[model samples]
Target chain A: MKLLESGVVSENRKHIISFIILAATLLLVFPLVFDIFRLNLVAKYLSLAFAAVGLVICWGHGGILSLGQGVFWGLGGYCLAAFLKLEAAVNIANEAGTDQIKALTTVGLPDFMDWNQITELPYIWYPFKSFPITLICVLIVPGIVAFIIGLAIFKRRVSGVYFAIITQALCWIMEILFVTRQGWTGGINGITDLRTCLGWDIRTQAAQYTLYFLTAGLLLAVILFSKKILSSKLGQLLVAIRDMEDRVRFSGYDVSNFKIFSFCLAAMISAVGGALFVLNVGFMSPKLVTIAPSIYMVIFCALGGRESLIGVVYGTLIVCFGRTYFSEQFPELWMFLMGGIFIVVTVACPKGLAGLFESHGAKALAFLKKFLKIENLASKDKKEVEA
Target chain B: MSSTDYALYIENLTVSFDGFKAVDDVSIYVEKGTVHVVIGPNGAGKTTLLDLVCGKTKPTAGKIKFDDYDLTTMHEQDIVQAGVGRKFQTPSIYPSLTVFENLEVSYPKGRGVWGALGFKRDQEVIDRIHEVADMIYLSDKLQTPGELLSHGQKQWLEIGMLLIADLQMILLDEPVAGMSVVERKQTADLLRKISQNRSILVIEHDMNFVREIAHRVNVMHQGKVIAEGSMETVEKNEKVIEVYLGH
Candidate 1:
């Protein structure tokens, strides 16, 4: 309580403002920042950033290390894709002047979809036809899923590695569900050939940029929102819960409610990011939502500096950029290099690349001196390299 | 306090872990604005009893009342909101949070999911935090990270946090377990000041520290109150002597 009165908030505000300034400037130049191919790639990176921000809240701030944020991301993507596929079918039927109600959209209803006897579009598919509700549903579907999952896990007082495992299971389960439910989801193939999203010609660069800028804006908003929480009482409480939840509960703060709230918020953020991602990419599949990519998100957070939002984005951009730029150039060696980088980070620069540039890094270095004298001796050489 | 003003009441409340009753059918009353110390030998359930009262542990049986609420049915957080704050034997401050942010977490209701996500300090709460910080002698270290503080300072920060929450009753588990001599003295004085307006249930091992501040002491052995009275009276009780002071 006494802590906030002094100067923490002001310092945090400066960091946030500068970050906004940096993000705004970048958004303005996104068209020219990279070529169209790379820009599309950046769009994917933006989605990854969105998902990582949720991780920061759940794992970094609240101490629930969810290795499965990809579940929420995948859910959002699938919900949006589902509507688009239905809308495409309806549009094709309408264009063909065949409201016969019984005309099949595709072969054998894909798999789970009932094709033969269905003449009219299901009422459930009606709301999705309207862009506004579809938009709302995009956010709601994942939000509801995260809420229910968080309610169950947090209520029982689950924490630490156990919480991480459950979230992983959640992602794995979702991927399996999506893959198995081929009729509804298009299964392993996923719904594709989407030319329009929300009545906009997604093929147009303006539309692409509109979605891109929106993604950037959302990421900024989330960063600011998280910054506020992280600076205030909730942030402190969250950190306390992470360090020692029993102490916080005894302190009368209701650790469970806070955990659930943070978890759900993280999920919602991942959902938003996921929806934006599919809209930009024009496709999504079970492959994108699988455990490998989910764990890759965790690795990005680790590489970026788990505690810093800026770091997460930075990590995503760097790694995603590498996977894109280096894969074609050195396909044989790309994965090996990525794995090596993670090893180097985990074993060597564990403060993450971001810490190297932070002010407290010197103090952190000092703290490390207590255990690692060799690092102390090598600082001058590293500084020369950095310089 | 008068009979009507009793701060907390417990009746045969018991808790068991793996078939062992850690807190066995215990009932006690704490007077308002008094410093009541619970003293017991190690593993005598001193902590488990505090946990039960604070809603950190659910009892296996019985009834406990706080202010006007049923303790057994209450959530840990609502119990906190019901005007009870707790301080653990260990310093529970977030090492990464500054002393001020640590204090802010003690605010009762700012945790609105939306509000909490973008919160700033209210001027009044900030002023109250300053007052408590000065009282606890933590004003100078307001910006210091909790992990950087000495053990004594960390203890003060935790107590300082509970004070800001302004609970009607505070459950302190061994508040002086690891304090240095000077810090211990400061804590004793701080407790005296806090208890002037609120009931304090302090669990402690150091008899001298207990005698310094406790208006009354409750002794426990094997999960039941053996004797209850002032330090001097409990010190002379035959059962208390056999369980704690003797041998």
Candidate 2:
């Protein structure tokens, strides 16, 4: 009892400390350090952190690697973007003169639909018409999609590189669907010109600030919730499954159900990130839903330490910042530079930043302790001579 | 023997890998509360028979009845849940988890995803862990990670995991293959202790260990059981001596 209690207390303390540092950095530090434009960009990157965090749970802990996280993110972004686009259309129609409205061809349809000769809103777009339904779809749509995908794949016992390839293929399919279906989807351009959400001018600096905090807040909540799971028996079982799948199966666990749960949870979390990405950026695009971004999200988790939730957050921030800075400074060389960094980080620190910290951080602490002991000895000698 | 008197009844069990029958037409009955050991030369299909009974591998033609459940048609986990536990040849404990956690994870409760998430480390779980840990002689090493354990301890830890699940029958694949002499003795004692109220089916090569624990012995040669009796009686059998014991 004593051993268990002490273990729980220490574990809780470590989690508490990490949570405080992350919460302060996201909620306090970033807001104070960066201007609104940069802060908005941080919010965008933090939105992707949701996907990284999900990867930590699914790929890192559960040992199920998914390369199509962007699909769920895109689904979420498109869900909210659809709603906002409709609202923007209504706003445009209300503010337009009779001649301008007639020129639009459809009074309250998104401009892309009007341009594509889509006379009426499609049935799929009907759910996005209501904010409450859109909110539910943002979570459920991606959740159900993930659930179905997980059930099909995991139940069949398809895993490892095969699962990763299947998810990558899913991203490719989504990208094509979003690109070719111009009337229903925004087609390559995506659902842009998303000016308002529930009559609130989300484009305003004040709204941007609010969205940034909201994103940070939600991301922190997700981290905490994931921590709860990791500390639970379910988390231990995932680790056990990863180690010896046969043993866990023989231990009477269905195994696939846990895998499905992790995958669905990851998809839902990624979808939430997607919704925030739409709100913060004021647009949702097929570009963000493609293979490259999905792979990049995986790299974010990998580079941060796939196993470390807070480390992935830092990993996302660093990579996103590096991308923005490099792209601005050396547009031609940034891709290579980013690639080089990823290779170096992964090769040098295979456990990612968290592993680096664990190994070197302990050594550094030991050195600090030794240095402090020497200082204390010197102070004691001086005090004795004075006495 | 009447089927009701036996804890495990495997009949006409045959498994083939591309026309190569690993376990062919084997029938064995393990009486309740008894230790049944299958001893054989290498490639004699002793392990395959255990795999068939535990649902790790489906038999090409056979029926394995564990109490009232049809083990042949059940999933590996379902077989386990139906009070059958299997230990692999190697120590297959979770290396990252502590010994206590290894045992705790195998405890019968919270097998589902949500149940696991909400599973509390309650007094009952803790008490059971301690109880099993002591039984396996790993009480002091409960907090140690499984990887840190010596080879013998890892095997015992795996056994403890099976025991904590309150299984009625255990399928052991060479429980003491890599143990030191002392560990082998302790394991012999541990097996005898655990088999008090339950049935144990073991695949073993160590004759002395088998002699120490097996209530009944079956000697197999080329996917067929050649002899069945006590160690002394099996040693006296002509076919067992010619094929396996080789004077």
Candidate 3:
């Protein structure tokens, strides 16, 4: 009881409870309840949850509204997909029987490159040939991009709606680049036919199960990592920056540097999600790296309660499930339904599902406590009369 | 006066907003370990002078030297790191943070990105926060969120934030503008206590508070300093009485 009364301890207890609940659902219940196919879908959703978590930090806490998270996500997805596709092409080349087939396969070009009739591979794609390099690229590429962007705008003190618009434009530019450079980027279809990673076939049901657990595990780790950041003084500074930017500046902090750190951190986390996404779904498409999907990612964070890490995981799950269910049942109206839900959530509960739970959850607990106290009193009175 | 004996030395400080000078040729020298108050009428650019010294507004021409550091060339945070602190006209505490957090963030350490992330709330930091809170009369409200604080409490909290930074020089812009009589008296006493070791430059309109705390006073009229002396000397000056005190 004394431990529970301590604010920090109780807050930590709540987080631990939420984490355990999420872990139980993702690791145990979902795998048992759903078949391999449905489980794969959950993996896909969890992958996107990475971006949602990043948004919780960047947008919710730091007050940096990035409308182009998809760019970082795509950066991660493409980095891994490029590596996997190169390996698959190498396997094909090794198995080629005819000289004509051998000539194309020997070049070690992705299929899209061949389709474009490019005789030589682009120098940019060389790094992807090495798996280790690809892994490093997945993390750092997004961070570097975010760093440059952050330095340019944040240092200049350009933020709020302008920053959001700039990010949206960046997403548009990436989409266009991906679509036009069909030879390099697989054009509109993106990099597909990823058969294996280091000779481990990813298409198998066993692989799918392993990938699901990996995604869940990674998501939990990301949550814990984000929690660490929020628990630190840096986290308090972020909230302080959001509320009073100038005060933070005058308090001897380089406010722009903190903002840049947050933006870069968010981008890196989203990129990790993107890499996992490619592994689960076996494709990285230009379609995913556009403004619409990027906005949807923001919606996931907003609906989940941008401030709550656990809430965002639930927000991602609920929204993704809704997307699948609606698309299946009302394919024509699903888009409208999703839009309506976002508007409703924004209007009715601006703080998202986490806010709703916080306000109502406390009241519900109090009511339960009162009911238990009354029951205990009646039982004590009966015992006394009997004695 | 030699620059070494003064904590802040402003010379030929001029800031023009599209040809109209908000502060024109304003020069004031604040001696080390003294409370210097700037008293002026509305539109007299008293606040603007503080803004120029603190790097909130850049001077079109002239030098602002704070203990050998050229404040005119420094950024806002760098100026702060150079041992100078400024409080705005309004209370600017982080509303969501507790009174303790408000002071802790201002504790001068962990001013960098990585530094803040690795900063530990050790006994030293806690002790400093409690000490500042107690000084601001918010010791009992350490855990209370800043937004819940009364207006006077918020003002004190902002002052406490600067106190925690332990800056060598402090600039205060109307620190007691909206404060009640009791709150103003507390602030006057707080200023006198804090001014023992450091230099303070305050812009205030209250004559009683000014007289109570001002070790030296500069009276400004229409973007320029008209008189400089002790409170009684400045009050007795014919020019100061004609332009400001008469109104």
Top-DockQ candidate index: 2
Error of 3 at A302 (Å): 1.2
**Native contacts retained per candidate?**
0.66, 0.86, 0.92
Ranking by lDDT: 2, 3, 1
In model 3, the clashing pairs are none
For every candidate, C-alpha RMSD to the true structure in Å:
5.7, 3.7, 3.8
**Taking the tens digit of each residue's C-alpha lDDT, what string does model 1 give over B40-108?**
999989989888887778899987787678878888878887888788888788788778778777765
> Please, what is the TM-score per model?
0.87, 0.96, 0.95
As a TM-score, model 1 comes out at 0.87
Residues B88-197, candidate 2: write the lDDT tens digits. 99999999999988998999999999899999998888899999999999998887899999999999999899999999999999999999999999999999998999
- After superposing candidate 2, which stretches have Cα over 4 Å from the reference? A366-387
Each model's DockQ?
Answer: 0.51, 0.84, 0.69
Candidate 2 structure, TM-score to reference: 0.96
Candidate 3 per-residue lDDT, tens place, B1-247, comes to 6776689998898999999998989889999899999999999998889888878899999899987899999999999999999999999999998887888888889989999999998888888888888888989888679999999999999999999999999999889989999999999999999999999999999999999999999999889989999999999999999998988
In model 1 chain B, where is the ten-residue run with the lowest total lDDT?
B108-117
Task: Give me the runs in candidate 3 sitting further than 4 Å from their true place.
Answer: A1-5, A98-100, A103-106, A368-387
Tell me chain A's TM-score in each of the predictions. Answer: 0.84, 0.93, 0.93
